[model samples]
Target: MTDRGRTALDTVHAQLDAFNAHDLDAFVATYAADAVIVGVAPDPIVGAAAIRAFYESRLANPDLSCTIDDSVLFGTRWVVAQEQVVNAGVATETIATFDVVDGLIARASMLKA
Candidate 1:
């Protein structure tokens, strides 16, 4: 893979690792300050702080965990992945699109499947 592709994939892996570990600090660090998250609520979640707050509640659940089932990296900026998320004993599948810029996640959009 090219350096840019490797960097982008690395950032994606880091974010997933942090998320699976439920490490709020590390998870938030993988995102840009102005990163936006969509499909979690009625309106898009803007900024890292809001993203942190949004995840805080979900991560607080002890039964929450996500596993990447499949993934495809497009160029050096986007990663489209299929994930299996389990929360409160319920398993749900989601397709997620992540945009990486300068080694940080700039935006993420998730769609339930």
Candidate 2:
């Protein structure tokens, strides 16, 4: 992998770690202020504020921890991450697509695996 690819993967890992730690501020910091998030749930969430709300609600769950299972780079600017999310005694896997711009996530899209 090139340096840029490594950096992007590292950024994605850090974001996932922050999310699992329920560190909202840190998680949001990985994204651009105007980042667009899609398919977080059944509905598409847009912008950092909306993404933060979704994450906040998820964090409210007593058993919410997401683990990244795998990540693949489509190009220098795009990546797809397969993750397992555990909540309320249930576990589900999902695929999250991310678009990186200027070393920051500019967009994200999630889908059921």
Candidate 3:
């Protein structure tokens, strides 16, 4: 993989790690200031502050955790991952796509896997 690809992957990994650890600051740090996230809610979550607010409620759930089943890097900026997420004792399979820009996530989209 190219350095850019590796950096994108590393940023995604850091987001996942911070999420599982419930480290709000670290998780939000992986995203750009104006990042947008889709599929997590009815409307897209825009900006880092909004992303932080969204995850804050989610991280409050002690039963929330995500495990990656597989991941692939598409070129240097896009990453797609199949993940299994457990929230409130219910498990869901998710396919998440991430767009990384300048070492941070610029956009994220999630779908049922």
By TM-score, the better pick of 1 and 2 is 1
Q: What is the Cα-based lDDT of residue 62 in candidate 1?
A: 76
Question: Total clashing residue pairs per candidate?
Answer: 0, 0, 0
- Rank list by lDDT: 3, 1, 2
Models sorted by TM-score, best on top? 3, 1, 2
Model 3: residue 35 alpha-carbon error in angstroms: 0.2
Q: RMSD of candidate 3 to the true fold? A: 3.3
Stretches of model 3 off by over 4 angstroms after superposition = 1-6
TM-score of each: 0.91, 0.84, 0.92
lDDT of each: 0.86, 0.79, 0.90
Candidate 2 residue-wise lDDT, 2-78, digit = tens? 12444677778878888888888878878877888877667667677887887887766668888888889877778
Clashing pairs in 1: none
Better of 2 and 3 by TM-score: 3
Q: Looking at model 3, which ten-residue stretch has the lowest summed lDDT? A: 1-10
